[model samples]
Target: MRLEQADPKRLVAESYRIEGITDGECRSIFIDWALSLPVGVDARQAIKRLLAEYRGTAPDHPMTAVLRAGLHKAPQARRRGGARGRRI
Candidate 1:
């Protein structure tokens, strides 16, 4: 996927330009990027595309690590109200 499609807001791209950016900051920026994507855009594909775009130039970047972590995290389904959610 094109960088434009993956990161329309350029949040991830801009994060790389910020010097000394921390992992927490990267994570925050990544969240912003994720939230900015158009509905129906696959976030993992976007993250992978961003990773591919930047990895060679900034493998050590905190954003890179955040993107990698984003790729690995599984979507966990949780009950909205615990056992009370169960129909008796």
Candidate 2:
């Protein structure tokens, strides 16, 4: 089903549910989902993009928070140094 046919928020919520994510974490995941898309891809494609990258993995609230703040910061915790990476 397409994102327009399916609720974008609900899709995101379901993704969170599958990953056992919290509500606060949803916003970040949703944002990351949005950013991952090509410039003009539709919402369905956007959701698909997010799912491809994030689905199946458990949500990390702290990581979500950083990603929500800015995609560039999401990997900071995983970096060998404190340098920020490229933005999503």
Candidate 3:
């Protein structure tokens, strides 16, 4: 996805401008960015692009971990079937 396609475009832009931003601050921004994502957008891919663009300049930045965490976060599994399926 292109940068413009990212949710909260202003937040993402501001995040990159932060000089020596703290881990906590990055976490907050990350949450905003995540929440702003549009449906059907590949979060992992979006994050990867952001990481590559920003993290490339500072691989050790605290934001890297936060973004990486988002990429690796697994979706929760939904339970199916009704009580009738149980061994009664």
Candidate 4:
């Protein structure tokens, strides 16, 4: 009963089809793909599915690399040398 595809626009899928696609291009496409997901859809799960879909077919594709990178959550950066945290 799913209403939409995990990749509604197939941006990720198309990225793999592109010739000589770069990581930067893949990144841009990934961003658009992520934003295009229907509200309430789980992005993590979508990413996993996308990875599985392309992994075997295009293991070295830039889009596949981008999707794999997307699976990881970046660490929060803390401010350094901030005066606000200092007190007299």
Question: Which candidate number has the best lDDT?
Answer: 1
lDDT by residue for model 3 over 1-88, one digit each (tens)?
7776754466766876789899899899988888888888888888887877777787787887888888775888876578865646
Q: Which stretch of 10 consecutive residues in model 3 shows the poorest summed lDDT?
A: 4-13
Model 4 Cα lDDT, one tens digit per residue, 2-80? 3246788878777888899999999999999988998888988888888777799899888888888898999899766
Query: What is the RMSD of candidate 4?
Result: 2.7
Lowest lDDT 10-mer window, candidate 4?
1-10
Model 2 worst lDDT run, 10 consecutive residues: 64-73
Q: Identify the superior model by lDDT, candidate 3 or candidate 4.
A: 4
- The top-ranked prediction according to TM-score is 4
Descending-lDDT candidate ranking: 1, 4, 3, 2
Q: Which stretches of candidate 2 lie over 4 Å from their true place?
A: 1-14, 17-19, 44-88
- Residue by residue across 1-88, what tens digits does model 1's lDDT show? 8889999988999999999999889888888888889998999998889999999999999999899999887889987787789868
TM-score of each: 0.83, 0.31, 0.70, 0.85
Candidates 2 and 4 compared: the better one by TM-score is: 4
- Candidate 2: count of backbone clashes, pairs at least 3 residues apart or interchain: 0
Better of 2 and 3 by TM-score: 3
Pairwise lDDT winner, candidates 1 and 2: 1
Off by over 4 Å in 3: 75-88
TM-score of 3: 0.70
The per-candidate count of clashes, in order, stands at 0, 0, 0, 0
Residue 13 error, candidate 3, Å? 3.0
TM-score between model 1 and native: 0.83
